[model samples]
Target: MDSPTNSQKTVSDDEEIDYSIKPELYDSDLDDKDEQWMAKKRDGRTSDAVLSCPACFTTVCYECQRHEQYVTQYRAVFVVNCEVDKDRVFQPNAIPSKVGKRTRDSEKQETGSADNERLNPVFCATCSTEIGVVDIEEIYHFFNVIPSEP
Candidate 1:
């Protein structure tokens, strides 16, 4: 086997190297496993697509999928109780309501203690438009939302 020579050296002592990187290597924090995870998080309607707010065309979230626990489907729209991996949500783009108690009006009829964290309304950070809801399971359900290519 040929050994790497000084001329073939790609990184310097001051530089960092992580061979486990995949495509979009600029995101050093993620690896092949993360890519695979993101790939698996696609929905039937919008496969590996970017989700945006229909009102203001603001970018809301991306690579979201239908809720695994309860699969829902809406007419004309692809997302039915859409959700993205917790790590994929861009905190600045997707705004969620403050932690509070779950209301009786929630989709699920189950009630919990006051201290229990409740589902939250998610909005577009830029437009403050109602985009979806984040359930107690921490899944984002996009309603009347638009999907765009990444």
Candidate 2:
């Protein structure tokens, strides 16, 4: 998807894309698996394919299935180039965040409280379909995603 604003360029379906780096790569912080994927991209042996919401064809992100889960638990990137509406939330992960070493008691003490930590749900702006989750506690971005496939 092309940015509605002209400063950003849209990629054609047939085009061969090579981004210096995808934002998600940094977001994940690069595990060994992620590093391998990066090496492949650098060598021009592989590239990411566009992953979009099937319901509305809204481009959600560009990713390689291999490099996925490098940063987040699932192989989805929330801070993707695609457009979404934050207001139209539907579902949330029933599971709680299992951040390391912090017990329920510790979480309450460390950050003042665990209540402040939040995971944002991503929805399709056009169809309101839930696509992914964002960790809003640290900042205004997603820590994980469920990349939609057509």
* Candidate maximizing lDDT: 1
Worst 10 residues of 1 by lDDT: 73-82
What TM-scores do the predictions have?
0.36, 0.35
Question: What tens-digit string does per-residue lDDT give for candidate 1 at 13-81?
Answer: 546756676646366655776657645754333454567677778756655554455444112223333
> Which clashing pairs does model 2 show?
28-71, 134-142
Question: In candidate 2, which residue ranges exceed 4 Å CA deviation?
Answer: 1-49, 63-116, 137-150
What lDDT does the true structure give each of the candidates?
0.54, 0.50
Candidate 1 TM-score versus the reference? 0.36
Candidate 1: where is the Cα deviation over 4 Å?
1-47, 66-117
